[model samples]
Target: MRKNLFHNLALTLSLASSSFLASYPTRSNAEGIMSSSPITVVVAEFINESDANWWKEKYKSSFKNMLTNALSNTGNFTILEEDEEAIDRMTKKRSLGIIPGFGGSKKEDDSLQAKYIIKGYLSEYTENEISESTQVDFGAFGGGRMKQMFGKMGMNASPGGTQKSIKEVDLTFNVVVINPRTKVRAFTRTIQGSAKEEFLSEDVDMGFVKSQKKVENKFPIKRAVMQAMEESGKYLNCVLYLQDDCIDEMDAKEAARQAGNDAMDLF
Candidate 1:
C-alpha cells in the first residue's frame, strides 16, 4: 500500500512540476536595506563584465529591474532617472524659467528632488560547472542482485547514490553610490555570494542518463545576481548622507544581508 502511495505521489509531483529552464532569484545570505525618506538619485546602467554572454544579450533589462527594486527597498533614495522624459522636461522648464510650481499646481514643487546617483559594475562572475554521472544498470535502488554481486567482489554497494542534479555557484559584484551635486564617489565596495544544491528526484526514472537534461538549474546565475543585489543597500547611507554613521565593507555587507532578510516578506 505504501509503495503504491509513493508511486502516486511521485507521479503527481512530476505532473505538477515543469522542466528546469530558468532560475528565479532568492535572498542571498547577504541582506537588503530600507531608506529613511526616499533620497532622490539617478541609476546609471550597470556595466556587465561577468563573462555571461547569454545574460548580456537577453536579461540586461531584468538586471536593471532587480537593481531598481532593490534600491527602492531602501527607504533613503528615490530614483530620478526612472522616467527620462520627466527629468528632461524639468530641465527644459528650468532653463526656460517657466518654473514648475508657479505655472502648474503650486503643490508641485520641483525643489524636493533626487539628490544622488547610483552605479554598479559587474566586475567578476565565474560559474564553474562539473557534472558526474554513473550508470544504474541494476535494480532501481541498486540493492537487489546488484548489491550482492558488488559486495562479494569486495566493492561497497549503495554508495548513497542519489537521483539528483548537484550544482555549485559563486558570484561577485561591485557598486558605487555617487552624489551628483558634489561629483563625489560617496561609497563603493565589492560583495560576493555562493551556494550549492542537490535536486533530488523521487521518480526512479531519474537515474544517471536522465540527469543530463537538468543542467539549467545546476548553476542558477540570475538567482545569484538577485541575491547579491539585496544586500548591496547597506553602504548607501554612509555614502549618501550617513557620513559619520558609516560602516566598513564587512560591516556594511553584513548590515545589508540582515536588512534583506528583514524585508523579504514585503514582496
Candidate 2:
C-alpha cells in the first residue's frame, strides 16, 4: 500500500511538470523565418503632405521605395512585386467585395491565401524653428573730485541692456499601423528631435547684427522617421505576441538567483 501511494504521487508530479513545460511558450523564430512563407503584403500608399505649401512630391516615392526595401530585408514576408497582375486582381476583388479582404474574415483566411497585410500613414512631417533669447544690462559709473576748494570733475552713470537670440531646428514624426483584417491598430509611435545650428551673430554697441541662416538639409527629419519605423517593426514582431512569456521567464530566473544567494549567505 505504501509503495503504491508513492508510485502514484511520483506519476502525478511528472505529468504536471510535463504539462507546465508544454504550455510555456518557447522563443519564436517567426521573424527569422518570415521569408519562407508565401505571405503577400500590400504596402499601402503613404500621404506625405503635411503642411499645404511645403509639399515635396518626390519624397513620397522615396519613402515608399525605402519602406518596401526594408520590409523585404526582414526575410519574413514576400512582398508582392508591382508587376504581379494576380495580386492586382486580388486587390480589386477584395476592394469590390468579390472576395474578402486580407484580414476581414476567419472563414476566408485560408481562401484569401495571404498571411498578413501592412498599412501605414505618414501622419506628420514638419520642421519648426525654435529660438531662445537672453538679455543683459551693462552700466558704468565714475565720480572724481579734483581740487579741495572746488569739486572739479564729476560723471553721471548710465545703464543699457542688450538681447541675444539662439535658434535651432525641431523635427517631428508620427506613425501608425493597422491590422488589415480587423481594422484594429497594432502599433503606434512618435519620434522627435532638436538640432542646433551655428549662430553667427554677436552683440555690438549698436545692438546686434546677424545674418539669416538658410535651413540646410540636416537629415534630422529623415533620421526621426527611420527610428520610428524601426521601433514599430520590433513592436510588431516581439512586443505584440512574445513579451509576456519573456517577461515571466526573466522574473522566474531573477527569483531563483536571489533565492540561491540567500541560501549561500548562511555559510
Candidate 3:
C-alpha cells in the first residue's frame, strides 16, 4: 500500500507539471522546429525613402533589427534570422534597389520557411529646432534707482534671463506583412511617432554677444523610432494571436491619437 501511494503521488505531480506548462506556448529550437503552434515570421530589410542624408542603409538594417526584437519579445511568434548578405545582393540586383519577393528565397529549406514576411519603409522624417531668448533689463522696467539697488546685489541688470531651446522630431513609417507562399499582403499598417526635448540655460546678453549652455545627445529621433516600434510590436502580437481585446485597445489609442492631431491642426 505504501508503494502504491508513492506511485500515485508521483503521477499526480507529473500531471500537474504538464498542466502548468501547457498554459504557455512552446518555443522553437535553434533548428526552427516548433513543438506546438507558433507563427514563424521574418523581418525583411527595411527601405529608407526619407530625404535625410544621415538616414543611411545601415540605419535601415538597424530598424529591421528593432522590429525583429520587438516581435520576438511577444512570445507568440517564431522570429527567424534574416540573411543580410542575400538581401543586400538581391536589392542591388534590382533596378530600384528594392528586393523582389520581399527577401524570401525559394531555396530556403522547409524547416526554416517563414509563414509571414514583415516589411517596412520609412516615409517621412523631420527635425525642427527653435530657440528663444527673453531680454530682461531692470533699468528699462523701473528706473535708475531700482537698477542701482539690483546692481549692488551683484546683478548685471542686463538681459539675464534664461535661453530656452526646443527640439522636435517626427518619424513616419509603414509596416506590411506578406504571405510568402501566396505572395499576397496579409496586413499593412502606418505608424507615426513624435518626440520633443527642451533645453534651458542661463544666458547673459552683453549687447555684443550672448553665451548659453546647451545639452547634448538628447536623442529625440531615437525615442520617436522606439515609440513607433513598440506600438508596431503590440499590433503584430494582436494580429498573430487574434486577440480581440488587444485589437480594441489599439484601435482606441489610434483614434485618440488622430483626434489629438486634429486638435493640434486647428491651432
> Relative to the true structure, how large is the alpha-carbon lDDT of every model?
0.58, 0.48, 0.73
Predicted candidate 2 versus true structure: per-residue lDDT over 1-267, tens digit per residue = 999999999999999999998887565643432333534555554565355244476766555555666666655445654423443444454545554545455544333454344444565444555444443322221322222212222211111223333444444444455444444566554433344444333333322332233333443455555655554444334333344454455456447746865897899
TM-scores of all models? Answer: 0.52, 0.43, 0.64
- Report model 1's TM-score to 2 decimal places: 0.52
lDDT of 3 by residue, 37-130 (tens): 7687778888888885567668877888888888888778887666755433433334233343554455334224466778888988888999
Q: Residue 114 CA error for candidate 1 (Å)?
A: 2.8
RMSD to the hidden true structure, all candidates: 26.0, 14.9, 10.5
Task: Rank candidates, TM-score, best first.
Answer: 3, 1, 2
Which structure is stronger by TM-score: 2 or 3?
Answer: 3
Misplaced by over 4 Å in model 2 are 1-39, 83-89, 95-114, 131-219, 239-267
- Cα displacement (Å) at residue 32, model 3: 22
Candidate 1, residues 106-208, lDDT tens digits: the string is: 3233532555556777776666545555544443455487767765765544443335565767677778765544556766777766676665543223223
Best by TM-score: 3
* Per-residue lDDT value at 43 in model 2: 54
